[model samples]
Target: MQAASFTGILKAIFYMIAFYYIFRFLAKLFLPLLVKKVVEKAGQKFQQQQQHSQENPWNKTTAKDEVIYNTANTKNPRETKKVGEYVDYEEID
Candidate 1:
């Protein structure tokens, strides 16, 4: 096995720096295109969802289909119950 040399270390560092710069350049060129396509796809999906909601039968209601709840005829379920006797307490300061 060969021992590690200063030249070898320098070469490895150079390669690492070169790789980092190249990766950054490629990412700068491609990342925006990828992001734009993803955003467009998401926007299309959102538009499709909006269209689907607009076209949905359940979302449409006519005046005759409206429901009116008569709360005046219904008795209150939570009537006042006498759980305990009221106590009058006087505090002296």
Candidate 2:
């Protein structure tokens, strides 16, 4: 009785592993093609939009951008040089 039950359990486990490998193989074969189709469709839509539009918001220039300097002041600020005041090191014994 125990032997039959053990055999059935082993068979079930083997079938589960086989099914897992089959699913993984199918995914590997078709997943990339599915992704490629989605990307191509999106790219086609974007190209159509660009061809129909004259001025793109992405390329528009704003008033703030025309300023000579992005900073508050127009003249460049001078950076102060930093000098080390002191240094110490230990000698090998």
Tens-place lDDT per residue, model 1, 1-93, is: 999999999999999999999999999999999999999999999999999988896857676766799896587666787899989999999
Model 2, range 1-93, lDDT digits (tens) per residue?
A: 345688899999999999999999999999999999999999999998987675565667676665464775557687787886677888999
Task: Please list the residue runs of candidate 1 whose C-alpha ends up more than 4 Å from where it truly belongs after superposition.
Answer: 60-93
lDDT of 2 at 32: 99
Give the number of the best model, judged by TM-score.
Answer: 1
At residue 30, what lDDT does model 2 achieve? 97
Alpha-carbon lDDT, every model: 0.93, 0.85
TM-score of each: 0.63, 0.48
Which ten contiguous residues of candidate 2 have the minimum total lDDT? 65-74
